[model samples]
Target chain A: MLNLIANENMKIYRRMRTWILVILIVAIVLLTGILMKTHEAPPSSNWRTALQAQTTQLQQELTQVQGKHVFMPARATAGMEIQIKKNQYEISHNIAPAQYTAWSFTSTIEQRAIGVLLTVFVAIVAGDIVAGEFSSGTIKLLLTRPQTRARILLSKYVATLIFAVFMMAVTIVASLVIGGVLYGFANASQTYVYMDASGHVQQMGMIPYIFTNYAFNSVSMLMTVTIAFMISTIFRSSAIAIAISILSLFIGNTLVAVLSSYSWDKYILFANTDLSQYVFNGPLISGMTMTFSIIVLVVYFIVMNGLSWFLFKKRDVALT
Target chain B: MADQIAVQIRNLTKRVGNKTIVDGLSFDIPKGEVFGFLGPNGAGKTTTIRMMVGLISISEGQVLVQGIDVEKNFSQAMQHVGCIVENPELYKFLSGYQNLKHMARMSPGTMDARIDEVVKLVGLQNRIHDKVKTYSLGMRQRLGLAQALLHQPSVLILDEPTNGLDPAGIRELRDNLRRLAREEGMAVIVSSHLLSEMELMCDRIAVIAQGKLVSVQTLSDLMSGGERHVITSFEVGDKALALSILNRLFKDHVVDDDNHPHLISLKIDKERIPDAIQALVEGGVRVYGVSAVTKTLEETFLEMTGDGIIA
Candidate 1:
């Protein structure tokens, strides 16, 4: 099994396409950093004064909305309150109003670059892992090995997952190096501030924050890979698999938002894909918990993989 | 013992929707012999080979490789078998050596030494490091053969093994398959629609048409065992006299042919050719030429299958 996976890895990494993906990630990271650096809102030396002024304005707004009959949304009020609290906390702790650093830049890339571009790149890899073999007519050579069809499928799946992790690591390292070189490498132990699920502002280290974001984001990434893989197995065309997967990945959130009024929307895969909602903000739909979303994601994962295994094993390889 | 049999295909059948692709194919390939599966286009030759290698599912019956049932225990059965289904599709993005190494990893116990041995066996040592996309069809075929022989399987099966080879390449493949079967005691099964190639490569040939087995015979038996009739053509003088003389002496043996004026065609056994010639000479008919017509396998295949379905 290990050797099979190694074979898959060799096939993956030896191709110029895979290297091109890596280069794209690095280039995108550098371009984004260069763009950000050139945009120059020079670092404010009076950050404390700015924080105090922001806090005062937020307080005035809170007081005005407290007794007024003006129709303000409750969620908007809560968001303002959280922002004021985070500002006050930063001021009291003298955290200097989120200064630019290598750690922070890496964190930003994790949010912006890894969120969309990484998913698309990983989707391309996962999508092509199985269907590409069929398209090239090498599936005959692959399936006729002594290993069973199930084992071969498993190996490909595992190899795609390894590639996803490897790409994630590459993006992380690239973003950090570019970020550190452009912005200073100082503040390696910076603190990040955010609101918890209990409506209180909290602080965490920069490294942990990035990793926690990745951990939470990986739930959605996992689903994307599996969905692409399932489509890859079902169809013999890599373009179809990749296009549908990317389309769904971008459309999933919009789909959830469009249907958020429906009570059953909580059961949708996109709604549960963002497990961080349960950890920090809350579920997309009210009354959905972390356990429920985990269960939903697990079921989707199992069903997708089950269908892949069934189709891969039972369907005849009649490619002419 | 049952170990002498390399592959036992018993009542193997394949059905797609309402149509049968390969029906009730049963044959045992013994060790140290080259077996041929010959058929016309759309004759289920590829489908049958696919089923034997577990590429396609067997609808009704089973295939056993070295006495192990394929459908029951596919991996174990496949361990004893190595096959190339159709045109040897390799990883074109990878070098030929990398392709072989990739395949060698799948079949456990295939060492680097074994890979090198098979590379040398297929005579691909010089170009083995080049990418397959740069290879000609014949080179790819050799690499495909090398991949199949890497693990030293007891049974080696190739479908349309001579599809894209030049004459020399085809001859080399034939010699390699023959030597592998003879020296290593491996059972080599090759399928082709090219009858003459099969004639030179296979020890026994199984002919099928439209999913039905037509005949299975040894090469010699298929060529000369059953029929002794040779159509003898005689170029003679005095067409009327020669025809009359031939008809009088060999009444039922003479063919009513009018393609030539002085030529007489007779379907006669070999032993009676001298008597007919002497009788014609004594009857004052000059015999200029006497030649026996031979039937090629193409003619025999068309006769057996009875149509224009050959590729």
Candidate 2:
């Protein structure tokens, strides 16, 4: 099993494109850091003052939310209150706000936006891993080996996931290191302040929150990779697999938001992709909890991969 | 499952949709011999090879590689076999060495030294480190042969292995295959539409047409063994006089073919050659030259297939 996966890894890394993608990722992160530094926001001489200002801002937003009563005002009201209380707690504890710190680079909602870009990179690898072989006519060489189809495909799957995990880690670590170099490293050891799903303020050490936030964001990334890989195996066309994966990534959230009025929206595969939404932004619909989303994601994950494996093993590899 | 047999096909069949592409073909390839699948275009040679390697699903029957049924346990059966179906499909982005290394890793317990040895055996050591895309067609075919030999399989199956090779490359591949059969005791099955190449490369040939096996026999048997008194045509001066003298002496064996009256032809054995020539000369028909029309395998193949559309 190890040899199988190692063989795949060798094939993957030997491509110049994989390294180009990696380098592009690090370059993007560094460019973002440099731009943020050059156009530096107002320096927070004292985090206490920043926290007080943020708390006041959330209060005003909460009043406006109540006045308008639009766009799920209840959830919006709960979300504003949670953010305000968390800001107040940070202000009381004397933990200064620093968005550019290594920990904050991972934990901050704005910084977590980079995860989508990382998802595209990982999905590209997943999309190409299987379909690229077919396109290059190497699938004949691959399948005729001594291993069974199941073992061969399983190894490809494991290798793709490892690549996904590796890319995700690169995103996190690169951002963290860039953020630390541009800002300061001391904030990495600070406390992690956040709002839980129940509109309550919570606090944890920065290290734990840093890991959890990255891990939490990866649920959606893995979902996209699984879909991309499934398409790769079935269609044997890298272009179709990569295009559909990227299209779904950007359009999926909007479609869910547009179709939120429907009762069946909760069951849609895209609706359950962002598990972090349950804890970070609250559920898209009432009564949908993290555990419910977890169960849904697991089913879709298993079913998609089940179809991939079944088709990969049984389908005839014609002389394409 | 005989110890000497490396591969066995029993009633193997394939059907795509409503068309039966290959129907109930069976053959055995012995160890230490090069077996040839001789057929015309679209004769199902590739389809049968695909079924042996489990690339295409078999519609009926089975292929046994080293006594293991391919359909029942594909990996175990494939463990004893290595094959190249159609063109040698390789990862163009990878170096030739990396490609062979990848193939070597697929089979468990493959020695590291095996890759080096095969590289040398295929005469690819000089260019093995270059990317496959940079290599010429002949080099790629050599690399393909190298990878197929990496695991030291009991059976090697190559479909049209000489497709893109030059004359010299074809000769080199023929020499290597013969060496593999003789030195390593490996069973080899090579399919080709080139009858001359088959005659030079294979010890036995299986002729097929329209998805059905026509005949499978030793090369010599199929070529010249079964028939006695081969038709030998003589181009001589005054073929009419030569024909009369030879006809009177050997009767029925000698005749002046109406197609070319200047030449006399006869169906005579090796012992009767001197008598036929002496009769022609003593009759004042000066025999300028004596030659036998050695019927080529191409003629036999065309006769068996009933068509000349061989690829």
Predicted structure with the largest lDDT when compared to the true one: 1
For model 1 the local lDDT of residue A31 reads 92
Candidate 2 deviant stretches above 4 angstroms: A41-99, A106-113, A189-195, A200-207, B225-287, B308-311
> Best DockQ goes to which candidate?
1
lDDT of 1 by residue, B1-311 (tens): 58799899899999999889888999899999999999888899899999888889999998989999988988888888888888887999999999999998999888999988988888888998998999988888889888888888999999998887899999989999999999999999999989999999999999999898999999988876378898899999888998888888899989866877878889989999999999999999889999988777888888887695633
lDDT string for model 2 (A1-320, tens) is: 89989989998888899899889878888887787668866657876776788889888777776677544545556667767866775666555543456666555522445667778888888898889888877888878987787888888888988887888777777877887887767645566555666765566777787677667667887888889989998889999999899899999989988998889999988888877767665677879988888899999999999999999989988655
Second chain alone, TM-score for each candidate? 0.94, 0.91
Q: For candidate 2, write residues B128-155 as lDDT tens digits.
A: 8899999999898888888888888889
Clashing pairs in 1: none
